[model samples]
Target: MTAKRRRFVRDNGLTLAFGMAFLLALTGQAFAGHAEFNNELAADGLAPIGLAAYLASSEFAVDVTENWQSEYLQFFLFILGTVWLLQRGSPESKEIDEAGPESDKEQRVGQYARADSPHWARTRDWRQTVYSRSLGLLMGGLFLLSWFAQAVAGSAAYNEQRLRQLQRPMGWGEYVLGADFWSRSLQNWQSELLAVASMAIFSVYLRQRGSPESKPVGTPHGATGVES
Candidate 1:
């Protein structure tokens, strides 16, 4: 590789690695879901769908969005919660004494912002207010959008199966309030929430050497937010 290319990769290795893995996992899910969907079609005496057809179908869309909504919801909650709530010992949390948004100087906003700080951070306007909460805001927005998409796509996929079974189709409102939609959403939500909880609790005692997610190996368990 060119020296510049190697430096670029080194600078962004974490994001690049996870991005590639996400694509690969999504591709695998598409193939696996397509096969499973075809089996359901065969059982219902319906023609099996092509891979492209399956990918474009409500089934695939609902499956993807349900998971996406939950994942985004996890980050949204974590970001907002960490602002005001804190754990005593977890590296995932701030120092126990520091709760709620700190002073402008601590955050380097307004007059405290350095010359190299973001433009919004240097402002005292609405833009600064917006930028301050931008990460959580974006995650919450994505969660709502994906959840809405899941509801719409899920309604279509559920009604399609109902029709296959000679049952009546449900309205969008009905499906969103129904058991299937809640079941799909809740299942993913529980898992993601559990993961966040585990990370926060376990990092209090666990060591991960050089990982920022964990405290230093020699750090005391009572120390909070001391990343390696």
Candidate 2:
């Protein structure tokens, strides 16, 4: 096979492998969720849902979406926040001198763009303007979408619980204002923030021999990305 074909196969194979792993983990979560859901139903003298029904249920959707939203939010906040926030000697951060958005030349936009650069990168239009900040924008968009998904799904799940308890089912607006929504959102968000904060601070004093997340074992704590 040609080098191009080999490279394509390697890249595609890795992507497919990761995709399969993701689906496998999701499927495992679904099955475990279904079992746990049915256990709760049994405890409450309610009928248990089948796997397919459980998969389609708001419970599953809300649980998945809550985690998804938190992850996206973490990335979105970290990506945007790291611009202004400095973490000394952490690989996840920009250096002290590199605060704020860099110049277009540094970002390879307009005249500094390569021949094969994206059309938007070369264009003198709104598309180019948006594309320039597209990474953070897309991350923020995904964070919003996932958060919205969590809200919608959480409302359904909350209503289900309410109905199970012979209580009134809430409207979307009411559900949004309810404590359940904020509790779910805040719990995941707090954990994500803690994790991100820990990583930033811990990497300053820690070293993992082969991990990209850490500086080299022998490297000084002040060193940034000196991976072994």
Candidate 3:
């Protein structure tokens, strides 16, 4: 009922809505994935798996993990790259003069930190040191974790296929070095890079109306977030 409570609800409502939407979409994908996987099993003369079993299978794990790795890699690269790079008119990038990590004052750390700033910002110690690089660090770590998950799951999926054909199942090392693994990784990686590049370049000339991703419609093409 109070202003603070109303502000909190409004600020967090979008995040909650999107989180539920993402979960629903993922659940739908899992069901569709299970059905398709079972169809493949039938074609190969293998017993069809139930939804629970299919979800537990390496096929689902590998598919999910491969996509996750690509997403994390994209974020990791974007966060790190934007520090040194400038897109003249894009909302996603800082202006040319504001390049690099910028001063501690600009980042609102230590003496410049506000009363409600994060504890790490006030600590002035190792916590602040790590928190300063936390965004890129977390993204990089998640990328590695997702990549490893993909490798492990892919190996299991690959072995299952080999066994179905009465061929010898491969060891993890062999599977990691195989064409299938690299192909899956490269395909996703290329698409992610393409999307990021397109967003960076397109935002220079495009206007998305009220969307934060674009400058205001009336703004000059050379103008940046200042126009928004």
Candidate 4:
């Protein structure tokens, strides 16, 4: 590889690794889900669908969107929550004494912005205001979009099963208000919340030598927000 390409990979190793892992895991899920779907079709005396057909089905769409929505919701809530809420000794949180948006000087925005600071960071107008909350906003927007997709796809899949059983298919409104949608949504939400809580609590007592997610090995338990 070229020097520049090597430097690029080294600088973005974490994101690149996770992005590749996500694709691999998704591929694995597709194959597994396709097999399970075909098994159900066989048991129902219906013809088995091809992998491409299964991938385009409402079942697959709903499954993918439900997980995507939940993950985005986790990030959205975490980004927003960490601003006002804090843990005493967790590296996952800011210092216990710091809560809410600090002054422009503290954030190095406006008059306090360094030469290398982003343009919006130096602005004193609405652009700065919007840019300040951009990350959380984007995550929240993605969550809403994916959750809507999950609901629509889940409704279609549910109605498909209903039609197969010779039952009446409900409207989208009814489907969204039904037990299945809430069950799917809440199950993922609970797990995501639990994970964030676990990470915060665990980081307070555990050490990871080089990971940003954990405190340094010799860091005291009372030390909050001291990343390695």
Candidate 5:
């Protein structure tokens, strides 16, 4: 590779790697889902859809958005919850005694902002307030949007199945409260919550040599919230 290209790849390896993996996974899902969907169509004596059609279908939309909503919900809760709650020995948490947002000086906002600080960090009004909570706000907003998309798409997909079975369709409100919606939502939610909980508890005892997510190998398990 060219020197410039090598440097660029090295600098962005993590994002590039995950981006490629995401594309590959999404492509695989499209193929596998299309096949599974065709099987259903076959059973019902309906024609199978084209790849483009399947990609635009409610089944695909709901499947994608359901997982997205759960992921964003996990991050939203973690971002907001960590502000007040903490686990003593987990690197995933703040110092045990340092719950809640700290002082403006500690955060380097307003008068405490350095020359290199973000413009909003130097502001003293509503802009600063908004910027201060922007992370949690963005995460929460994404969670809401994804969840809403999941509900809308899920309703359409569910209704299609109902029609296939010769049943009446449900309204949006009724469908959202029904077992199908809750089952999809709760299953994703349970997995996300378990992952978060596992990360917190596991970090308390585990050591990952060079990862920011874990304490240094030599660090005591009792050392609260210290990262490598």
Candidate 6:
């Protein structure tokens, strides 16, 4: 590879790795989902859909968005919760004394900003305020968007299945309030919350020698938010 290409890969190795993993997993889901969907069609005496058709179906959209919404919700809550909540001995939290958005001087914004600070960090206006909380805003926005997508696509998919089973199709509002929607949503949500809880609590006692996610092996358990 070229020198510039090597440098780019080194700089963004983590994102690249996960992006590739996401693609692989998505591909696997598409194929497996298609097969399962076709099996349902066969049982119902309906024609099976092609791979392209299955990929574009509301069933696929609902499945994807259901998980997406939950994942975003996890990060959304984590980002906002960490502002005021501190977990002693957990590397995922702030030091107990640092619970809230700290002073401007500590954050190096406005007059206290260094020469190399981001442009918004040096500005003293609404723009700076908005930029400061942008990460949490983005996570919350994505969660809402994906959750709405799940509701819409899930309603359509559920109604289609209802029709196939000789049952009455439901309106969007009724479908959204039904057990199907809540089951799909809550199942994904419970798992995400558990994973986040595990990460925060596990880091307190775990030691991953060089990983930034864990505290240094020699650090005391009482240390909070100290990345290696």
Best by TM-score: 1
**TM-score, each model?**
0.99, 0.89, 0.92, 0.98, 0.96, 0.98
- Per-residue lDDT, model 4, residue 28, is 96
Q: Write the per-residue lDDT of candidate 5 for residues 65-132, one digit (tens) a residue.
A: 99999999999999888888898888889998899899999999999999999999899999999999
lDDT of 1: 0.96
Clashing pairs in 4: none
Is candidate 3 or 4 superior in TM-score? 4
TM-score for candidate 6: 0.98
> How many clashes does the backbone of model 2 have?
0
lDDT for model 6: 0.94
Residue-level lDDT of model 6, residues 31-80, one tens digit each, is 99999999999999999999999999999999999999999999999999
Writing each residue's lDDT as its tens digit, candidate 1 over 1-228 gives 999999999999999999999999999999999999999999989999999999999999999999999999999999999988888889989998889899999999999999999999999999999999999999999999999999999999999999999999999999989999999999999999999999999999989998999999999999997898
Off by over 4 Å in 4: none
Q: Report residue 184 deviation for candidate 4 (angstroms).
A: 0.8
Model with the higher lDDT, candidate 2 or 6: 6
Span of 10 residues, lowest total lDDT, candidate 1:
80-89
Score candidate 5 by lDDT: 0.94
List runs of model 3 lying over 4 Å from the truth.
1-9, 225-227
The segments of candidate 1 whose C-alpha lies over 4 angstroms from its true place after superposition are none
Whichever of 3 and 6 has more TM-score, that candidate is 6
